[model samples]
Target: MPSPVMPTSRRADGHTSPAAVSAAGLRKSYGDKTVLDGIDLHIPAGSVFALLGPNGAGKTTTVQILSTLITADGGQAQVAGHDLAADPQAVRAAIGVTGQFSAVDGLITGEENMLLMADLHHLTRAEGRRITTELLARFDLLDAAQKPASTYSGGMKRRLDIAMTLVGHPRIIFLDEPTTGLDPRSRHNMWQIIRELVTGGTTVFLTTQYLEEADQLADRIGVLNNGRIAAEGTAEELKRLIPGGHIRLRFTDPAAYRSAASALRETTRDDEALALHIPSDGSQRELRSLLDWLDAAGIEADELTVHTPDLDDVFFALTGPGNVPNQPKESAR
Candidate 1:
């Protein structure tokens, strides 16, 4: 992996802090509606930390506060080694934000957008040209560089938008639903770019309603619920926390299925469907026991599949009204 570029925090006198990004008891609210309640986050210098939640779960508000685009109601957070409250400018300088909405201007040429960002960062004319040329090539937008951004495809526009954010060479980036309206191919492409960024040691702060996005890109995931972190861990750990996960055994005939079901009386039955859902915590012990039971029954299964609740289960269980909706969004942004 590439080394991270983020710096540590500041000294009391004037130097930067030692941590890449740190927060303790961060809080924010709108009127009486509390958006973030005593939230805590710690992101290392070169890792991707995903923040997940349902829509209206305050993921955007949290991103806004941490990126210095908005203030927190209470609590402290440090970014790029600078205290958010004490040095907002330093935080802004060290980080890039690709919001849910593309920042590219539709009327401008692709190359012109990159130049605009370069100008905002105050890069010299020669340096700006170098950056524009490099980013356009990197994002595969060179052929379309002279074309108006409005003419670009959804994927191309998204690519250009993110490339523009990279013009200043920020050490950390905040991506809020960067692939919201993209098709599967475009979303996958964005995922690849994000992976490359983290591999190159850029810290990624991602907020998305898509659990699949977090599963694919996050080094660590934090589930936000009711303005708080209900859970935080690696993807596997969170999945293990939920129940109804199982291993399925497919049989060639009804007799074999019936015999197996009889043998494993503890497992849940789906007779009409010719399948059995054995409750599992996704553990090897359970799998071994299941295999042993099958062997003892002398009923060989035609096929076997491991079933585990994904981030969707985790999200709905932890955040919703305790119900998983049939919304077709099992966390793929």
Candidate 2:
């Protein structure tokens, strides 16, 4: 463990904000297998930072180390203005974690589960009941408050799990694949809940396998591959790093297709489809110029489409093939 230091960072809104979580040269190893290799992170307060990586890429391991569930092999980190190594208790007090699996007790009622969390956090009897009631209402679990958690839907269980994590009112939260088995509607509902949490000024550190989840929720995203970060930036910034943007022009007439193809020399011709794929950045100025060129060349395309690189493209381009070595049987996520 090393002394922690806070670093100033910019949020997605382009405003300077204090770092809620900062780590430098973080490393972790299990036996001969290295999980994290000198990773550095600086997350601003009141923002969502999503960590995207394939399985066995150490996303969970990073979350474990930062949440103080396990000690890092080497690193210095600060969470909520407290030194992570020097004051892990303080760090724990400032953060909440909702892991992949649900923590709700199936045997207990939803309200009882929340009361249990309140008890763990040392809340008084009256205070615990108040908070439990409020959270159940907030998460739409009030109607089923007295119902056994085992009878609750998957979404209700997850909501209860997160509600339990919020019992202490932490400033930072780490959500590891919060919507793993949720339906599309439930997932969207969860997204709204996360948005509401961030809106209230909580910093979120998310580790998710869903690319769309990251793109929709994260202010910034980091892709980890082979025990290292392959790339990190805003979703659009990461998309721009890959080179797949293009304009597709389709002509029903073969003669028109051939003529358009000849006019547009810098294009990949799809003879069978009667289409031409021209490299483009998808900028308005570029599109205008291209349209003008086509007009001048007397070319009329049956269809035109603009294709831009998305998070999926960036994810594939950055995290090539996953190659993780065997680890000890005791190793747990």
Candidate 3:
């Protein structure tokens, strides 16, 4: 078989790079129930790739296979430049994983837990202490470092879990539903942390059920459904894949509303609200043309807004009941 790892190339941002993670036709099954079905992925260095899906959609299974925590029943993968099957040890050394559940040892002090991770990575005692101190302070856990983790709030434990994951300085990190239970503020804070990691040249593989999380964080997103990738693209691109985009015009003056309604034959009229909905892709050219047409017709609208499909719309259309999966667009390397 050909190599799973591709050659280094330059990204649009002029960053010299190679694939941080790549896979092809990866498959896994639990008895008769197949999880991943011929899945493919290519994530570049220093980028975030979010896999989005509902529960039991194989997000964790894919993470396990790529992270070498479990073996795939078929296909190949390379992570951090090491062939997954041939050099799992090397792959393990270059990646860190923080699963959906917090890995904090609540019975121990937060500092002690950091020290334990430091030891697992085989750092010298002095080195361990130094990293543990820096990480705890960086994560703003210094005040609670000596306190039992059981006393920490949900957000605190989550932060501690990530700090522990960073103790090894892995280039690629797999975060499986990292913000599942975090409050809004905590979730935003975690998003900032993920951004900083990418800024510092770390590749992140995130799996999330939150459409907003995937929309905000991922450079590209792959929507998984029924053991397959329903579609894959940037948030805007995926949104464009579905319909329901339009331009809405509202008028306070009854005469203007009637005039516009008479002129625009294709618009859907809302007599009660004096609003008109015109089907549109909401592109710049379309908006300009619409404005010109209205001006020519001598019609003035009090309020105008363009409505386009968002990630939530894209998700439901692609993965909802009775929906057929679209062939995934080729992902950028």
TM-score of each: 0.86, 0.89, 0.91
Ranking by TM-score: 3, 2, 1
Candidate 1 lDDT over 53-171, as tens digits, reads 87888999988998999998799887886778987988899999999998999999999999999999999999999999998998899999999999999899889999999999998
lDDT of prediction 1: 0.85
Candidate 1 lDDT at 167 equals 97
Q: Mark the regions of model 1 whose C-alpha exceeds 4 Å error after superposition.
A: 1-19, 253-259, 270-275, 296-299, 325-333
- Judging by lDDT against the true structure, name the best candidate: 3
Give the per-residue lDDT of model 3 (tens digit) for 127-184.
Answer: 9999999999989999999999999998899899999999999999999999988999
Clashes of each: 13, 0, 0
lDDT of each: 0.85, 0.89, 0.90
Provide the clash count, candidate 1.
13
Candidate 2 per-residue lDDT over residues 190-292, each given as its tens digit: 9999999999999999999889999999999999998898999998788779776788888899999999888787899999999998997777788899889
Better of 2 and 3 by lDDT: 3
Q: Give candidate 3's error at residue 25 in angstroms.
A: 0.4
The model with the greater TM-score, 2 or 3, is: 3
Model 2 segments more than 4 A misplaced: 1-6, 11-15, 253-256, 295-298, 322-333
